[model samples]
Target: MQATSRNFKDNAHRALEDANLQKAMGFVRTGFIDKRKAAADALPEFEALRDAARDIKNHTLANLDRYLERYEAKATETGAQVHWCTTAEDARETILEICRSVGARTATKGKSMIAEEIGLNDFLERNGITPIETDLGEYIIQLRKEPPSHIIAPAVHVTQDQVEADFRSHHKALPADRSLAEPQQLVAEAREMLRQKYLDADVGITGANFLVAETGTSVIVTNEGNGDLTQILPKIHIVIASIEKVIPTLEDLGVILRVLARSATGQEMSAYTTLSTGPKRPDDPDGPEQYHVVILDNGRSAMLGTEYQEMLRCIRCGACMNHCPVYHAVGGHAYGWVYVGPMGAVLTPSLIGVDQAGHLPNASTFCGRCESVCPMRIPLPKMMRHWREREFERHLNPPAWRWGLKAWAFLARRPRLYQALTGLQVRLMGLAGRRRGRFASLPLAGGWTEHRDFPAPQGRTFQQLWAERKRAA
Candidate 1:
């Protein structure tokens, strides 16, 4: 919601000083990455699955219109109402219409980035409806009156202590002296509080993990059973998903599902993979009376013909951020948007204006780990570089970096000057290192040496060494 990423240094400084935050981040760093690694090791055909998944996504994007129409037809035929919203405004209007038609007062929502993108909860609240978050992570952040910091783990920065405080402060019925020490206690408290809300709520909203066109089913994978309760018990069920989530077949969904769990939290599979199609049948025991799937475009279709088309393949795995050196140092809040890390760098600029979010692309170290671990195998670095190019062309690049590139380009065009400049650099480093084999501080490089000392450059330039060896031969 901030529109721009904050400085990495400032965000990191805040994170380090907060004891609770440090504990929470430490848990995330260890748990998610380790689980994913073990899961990947167990799957012998993981690489093959990755390749197949990439093809499935690419194929879907290429023939998106066809799949969308087919999906709508099949979903409608099964008694589900499918609404296509081309922009944020259109999506908001469609949802409002549904809410008004149902006379919905209280809404229970599962975690949906697409809903976040469209600002659905705020709209509902403004229209005199109370919408509650059912996901544990989302519930914590919502109670604290904060937006999500990470895409997958919304409250990854919140420690157990923070959760206890939030529940104590918000839940009036909770005991005054209750020692809410562990996760189980916290979960139990929330579950007890929300049990009545689900049965009482008029409508439920959920995001789709995958929309199977073959069966007109919208699949959602959740660790908790909250999504099921959110959809089934309520009289009205609303699924807010992007149009891109559709897959042609369950087999295709299986390929993506294989990589999704392994890439997301390193689980063989999530605890629940629920596939729902429309409202409950008359013969059905208990289910929603109405079902509506709001398929939102919100600039995603625009990315199809562009260089960033590959980014649409993302399954929201969060692997890129898990392995990013910069993200490890700074955490999600630094990216200052709905999405974060490498995928965010490419997406923020596109979703928001390039100028507004151009700084995000520059935040990466161009480390290849993100792409390597990406379940979708999206060319993240290449996409980020494209954002960088967009920034450069529009003159959004900082004057210092722009000037440095210009200077480097000028010298690079002249081999003699370039070699001379390199010779001077090497000689200066040698002279500087001679005193103590290192320099604690450097002239323009002080920031680099602030936390880490620069490794001294080699004494001779490569060109000089090559020339001398040629003469000797």
Candidate 2:
């Protein structure tokens, strides 16, 4: 809702105080984690599957160009139009042109982070075309006139009461006497409302989970069957996805699939895993008449040979965010991107520019839960450290922090000074503990003392303890 993600602290403060948001966060913590654990426990080879999945992604990315060309050729052979656009505007313009040719006025859309990356809805709406979100979570946020907060669960910041209130306000045609109760009832109301929109829609757009290069198929997975409706019911279907989603084969897809659901919602697989290869054939009973695959390369090519290339392996499973304590407390909107949590911290800076989003990489406890749970095994904290390095190299860091880092670095490089500093700090903390057990307010630690007390240093510094042991021996 804000113009930029720069006001994270202020926004996080707001999120922390929201009781409704806390309830929503509670569901995410228990519900998502428990579901995934159950799914993982059901499979004896879950860890092995994760390893295989990571290998497939790594292999695919290494030969990305080759696979992409093969995919384009295969897709063309199948009668699907493959459009490659290097920029978001280029991709949007190409899609809009295709829609215009078909006289499409209304479009139904499935959940797509790539679409969010390009701001496609606003672009379509500005041109007087209505773009309707079809996914339940996405639909909720859209009706509430808000941007998605979470990647997997877009409306994770909203409570059930808030959703009911939104549905009542937006679904004005529904009688006031009609009860706005139960998840199922609310779902039925939305299902009925969107069913008409789907039937009447001129164009349907969806994002690909994995683009099978070998078969020229765009794979879309959903818990709801909306992707099927979104693709089939409309006369035309558009699949817009990033180039990085491409995998070599269906066998490779299976490996990733095993880990994807378990890491995200802990399902063996989502309810629907639809693979559409081109448009409807003459023998086909029902499908889109026209199929278009738009491959987006919005700054992704730059990450190809770079240290951040591992990030391309992300399957959008959202495991990292779900396990994040900071995200649980402050919520996804604080990160201010379509992708949030640890992944967002690394990605937002790259996509939005480090100068504008440098603070994101620092918004971490660096607990490494993200890396531990990541199915693709992307070292998120390591990537984030690279962002921090870039920020320092570019001199984009705040002047105060820049000086503080310089001072710390100077001391750290010199062991004598570092040891002396640590000893002094330990002595002062020990003295403070003797008086009050722990420090409520500590000088030179304005950041930590703000919300929490600093634990007293254990009797002595590590260096002091080690030196005394050596002397005794």
Candidate 3:
């Protein structure tokens, strides 16, 4: 769970050369994009749903304190414990205490990014408690001792062959000759191996997609049903979520859920959308004995009333990264953190610091595709630009970039001088590259040209062409 965000350039370079990663990244394009398009097209009210979802979240955030208080009162009424954590340390320690109170030797876990954000697994392991990941993708990455590359698809960076190898290596008791050539076979193996873990687990921990205030309910949406098992079978159920996850009402949650699955996986609805209010009632046959909700702030509260508040609307559908060209080229590991792609680029800076994650904001190409496809209508590219401005303001950017931007700004302030300088530079470059029409390598721009050639100017600048058109008219 240690961040390597500072080495993003190195990580991205390595990812670019990794054939396995490239092959796996292909799924990001064909799988999520087409399915989301089809699902959205099928639902005529999809756009309206997105707008409704955004407004619901905004309202909840505007009165977050009132909603959280109401949620806590209702949850407590149902005999659930609600713990508020202002920091990661507080959240981790709170979870450890809960595990200790239950005398938990091993805990079953559903895929929770809040857990990753707090380094919960390692903390639990260090404290002599075994944390078992039941979600298939989480289980795969847990076995490999790697952080999730994608939010929903943790093992997206891992290939089928790698998964098969990991299963063989971990499941030593199984037959060596067992066929794992197909994905279903691999799933069966993982399920069989994890089934015992679920039965033996003393406690179960999960993350909430939305914490409803009206009913004091924690909602988890999934396709595998692992989350349901993780939260229900164990004696104690612990729900870990960020503070912003709270919504005003069940009706508000319904609107968000309508778009969440479609935006994430192209499904009209997830196979399982489990809601747990608290512990089992006397009449209930199957449920946990106790329930606890740990809401962690972890720098999210600092985003309020700022330009970055729009980011809070994100439902983690991952539509931005699915369409991102940079994410496709480098994969999620290059972001060097839990969140990845466009959402990661903006959120990482806020959660971690802009100093450590400055490169993430700069990684985008300003394509704006992320904003267009986002279910919450988050302006991802705009937020990234905001991060860049913050980076520049804090003097965190490299000296060369600082000077380059300064130089550009100086010329840009004077229209005539900017035009004259660009015109001269363009003519010189045009003459030089007239033969080939592109430069394979250019001074001070090797980063751009290293992978491909940079197209040369076609003789005149846009201003000159516009002037000519005006004269002709």
Indicate which candidate wins on TM-score: 3
User: Where is model 2 more than 4 Å wrong at Cα?
Assistant: 1-3, 434-436, 462-473
Candidate 2 lDDT, tens digit per residue, 392-424?
999987898899999999999999999988899
lDDT score for residue 369 of model 2: 89
**Residue range 224-305, candidate 3, lDDT tens digits:** 9999999889999999999889998888988999999999999999999988898999899989999999989899989999
Candidates' C-alpha lDDT: 0.86, 0.89, 0.93
Distance (Å) between predicted and true CA of 291, model 2?
Answer: 0.4
Off by over 4 Å in 3: 465-473
lDDT for each residue of candidate 1 in 19-115, tens digit (9 for 90 to 100)? 6766777776778788989999999999999999999999999999999888888899999999988987898889888888988899999999888
TM-score of 2: 0.95
Question: Lowest summed-lDDT stretch of 10 residues in model 1?
Answer: 1-10
> What's the TM-score of each model vs. the native?
0.93, 0.95, 0.97
Error of 1 at 18 (Å): 4.9
